[model samples]
Target: MGTFITCAVTGGADTVSRHPRIPVTPKEIADAAISAAKAGAAIVHLHARDPKTGQQSRDPELFTEIVSLIRDSDTDVIINVSCGMAGDLILTDTPETQPAGAGTDLLGPRGRLQHLDRLCRDPRLKPEICTLDCGSMNFGDGDLVYLAPATYLRPMAQHIRSLGIKPELEVFELGHLAFVQKMSAEGLLDGAPLIQFCLGIPGGAPAEPFILDAFKQLAPTGSVWSAFAIGRDELRFVSLAAGQGGNVRVGLEDNLYLEKGVFADNDTLVERAVGLIRGMGGSVMNAADTRQKLGLDRAH
Candidate 1:
């Protein structure tokens, strides 16, 4: 298979104020996805932000607008909506108090998947895949922990399977892959399993060649996987991942810089990845081919 490029156009949460062109509205997000498809991206991962405030949103209507606009356009990229929302945690400073302060957005399985439920029911907007973060960890500094407890994940995995949408397993740490392997062995994941090695997310594995190698080595054999890193390591990981027989994911969602201190849009990042893949004597896969490769057309 050729190197597949998945462009994550916008993230549910981001440092959007730092960059001027982060897409906030449905029209802006759809336009970015269309441009990425034109630039050789096989898949477009989507996240919705409030139109007025630009904060992350779990509103089904926002997703509907973005998916509708993209489908209405000329592009034919596979839509991968983020099902990993409302996991943010911001804790108070007091050592003994242990109170989750202003930024906490944790939700139970059903609450977290409210938008995904709507997507699965909407024939026109149902995504080809949705993210399922395999484990939980300390997000950044003291008291900020991200949770995807097994108690929550097992049921959520079954729900995703029932929806007939592929769950792109997002493994941050090596232990996280254990759950994924378990799910696959138990027949929860249909077709070939799809995995995404999310590197350099504060608490996860660092963005380095050896760490990525370890992830690829430990994943379920024959799983179709893509790997990416955040910020400065983003492009470097692309080159490293290509050599390891993994697909590539790049876009403003992962990194804002096109060059040193220069902001970029989704298309530019994907175009650069296409060039990088071709430079390595590999070609970029188109949307239809990627879907076939990932067995996206298979019934659940």
Candidate 2:
């Protein structure tokens, strides 16, 4: 019930391409995790990057290295893997194209979850929490759409729950929240459901205070929730989320610049978020408190 902060260490496939300071290798991510923990982030939502090219990857080895590095550091931040990988989007050549392009890697629900299963199998790399994008929508600058129908989500939900890892339901819009509630009603999402209200993506929910408030109203009663805004509104939504009794998330995955033309690393983002949370008279939760608040069992 108290405020908790999560730092999304490195995100977006284009992050390294966009910012030189963004963490890329295992050591960099581990260092960033420690810095974030020191700056009051209780959780580090992880996404691995290709060491050479800095592109996003689901390689189990990469995940293992990152997790192990963090574990060895004694930082104690909760590790949350992204099950929302790159395999869901359908990017067609034109609006009328029946088939998607080579750039797209659309797959069935099970295929999308392959990396998640791999991570869950390793005791050392097992994520205490993982993401479950509740609904799908368009993701590109034009006509690319990501498919996440209930047909896909239901089976994925069962798999995540079976792994003994909590699913952080990522709701991009109010309708997505309604769908997540329906899943809870159907008993797919067991225990105290954790939800993340994602706002201000290109084709999803807009980042406005009223829009966030409406999504907050739609949250299942007694459920734990967090909220984040992408790009320019990241800090604004952190304040909004904390004031509204929800947790906050901030990092390079959602935004690149700390200020105009000024690139930010994970540590700077976490430091800024800590300042904002404390500035509003809200205290940031530690890893143990965060796990307790979200009903997550500590990983051995």
The candidate that wins on lDDT is: 1
TM-score each candidate.
0.96, 0.95
Please identify model 1 stretches exceeding 4 Å from their true place. 298-300
Candidate 2: residue 15 lDDT (0-100): 66
* Candidate 2 residue pairs in backbone clash: none
lDDT of each: 0.88, 0.84
1-300 per-residue lDDT for model 1 (tens digits): 798999999886566788899999989999999999999999999999999999889999899899889887857889998988878777788647777887898999878888888876768778889999998888765667888998988888899888888999999999998888998898888888999999998878889888888888888988999999999889988898987789999998889998897888899999899989999999889988998898887221
* Per-residue lDDT of model 2, residues 180-292, tens digit only: 88999999987888999889988889999999889878888878889999888998888999998889999888989898889887778888888888899988899999988
Specify the poorest-scoring 10-residue window by lDDT in model 2. Answer: 86-95
Q: List CA RMSD, all candidates.
A: 1.7, 1.6
Model 1 reaches what TM-score against the true structure?
A: 0.96
